[model samples]
Target: MSGPKEPLTRESLEPVPIQVFDDHMVLRPPNRLKERSAKRARTDDGGDRTVISRAENALKLLSQEFDAWMTKELDRLEEARRTLASAPSDAAADRFYRSAHDLRGQAATFGFPIAGLIADGLCIVLERKSEISDPTPLIDFHVESIRAVVRQNVREPDDSIGLALVDRLAVMRERALPA
Candidate 1:
């Protein structure tokens, strides 16, 4: 058994050119871990399927999961709406904020990217007006816009209708702003 080898002399070393990447540049490298834990993220049990096929399957599965998540978020949105309607209070605002916050974070992941964008705007409005005073119309409008996005099944962020909804929400915020 060898204990240790002698260190290589400076003369034995060779200079190699190095490439510098910009801070914003990301480089993906090949995974050297177990086959199951590869970048493609396959099951531990080896499959006859090729990497490409596995990637396609993953996309299909992701769509299914996205639909499920969307459904759950919609339900939460409904519950929040009902709470705000039945009793317009800080607690109601808090409940709605929680649901809106979740949508703001995950809407894009579930297919409705615009919903997340609009939800963020709505959250800001709610944050400022913590207490639902006389003007509940703004709150209703923001909530309706979000519900419309879900009901219409808007997935693309650039859709004309989605853009309009976002615009209206922004205008409502503008109206709320004191001169």
Candidate 2:
């Protein structure tokens, strides 16, 4: 094809002297050049470093405190349930439900999903029976179930069964309430 069209060559395509488009055009070095780390980076001062370390230490302490608080709440819920079993009164059931609700909130925050879910369901059951029934066996069952769940070290609450039970309890409570 006509000697390959002279290889489609360009006369000035090779490297040559740079030319300015205008008189005030300042040349800029390529931005892709590697930067010196010392020029771009800062050395951490002892004060700033210590502040960060102290913040981390504070967070660790707070986490430990929160864990302890959650454990105490769990123990309190267990005790309240036991007391309800012995007395079998509306006030006792109410106290047990309140304790269980607190335990559920704390356990959920602590990532104990199994305990949280069981406590949630138990709370609903207690609320429904708070005014009239002797809810000792139910309270004991809930306490044991929660203990077993805690022993198993569950990370997330299983909400399906708990939600179902909560719904049933809600309907029962609605029917029992004054018209």
Q: Distance from true position, residue 169, model 2, in Å?
A: 12
Q: Put down candidate 1 lDDT per residue, 1-179, tens digits, no spaces.
A: 97557564432254434455875545443333344344554587466567578997887788888878887886887788788888878887788889989999998878899889888987877677744454567867777777788889988889998998898788878778553
TM-score of 1: 0.61
Please tell me which predicted candidate would have the highest lDDT against the true structure: 1
lDDT of each: 0.77, 0.65
Clashes of each: 0, 2
- Work out the TM-score per prediction: 0.61, 0.49
Number of colliding residue pairs in model 2: 2
User: What tens digits encode model 2's per-residue C-alpha lDDT throughout 1-179?
Assistant: 45664565453444544557766545554333254222443466566678799997887677767656767887888788778767867787778778888877777666576677668767766666555465555556667767766665655445565445445544544555433
- For model 1, the local distance difference test gives 0.77
- Please give the lDDT score at residue 87 for candidate 1: 82
State how far residue 22 of model 2 sits from its true place (Å). Answer: 75
Off by over 4 Å in 2: 1-61, 130-134, 157-179
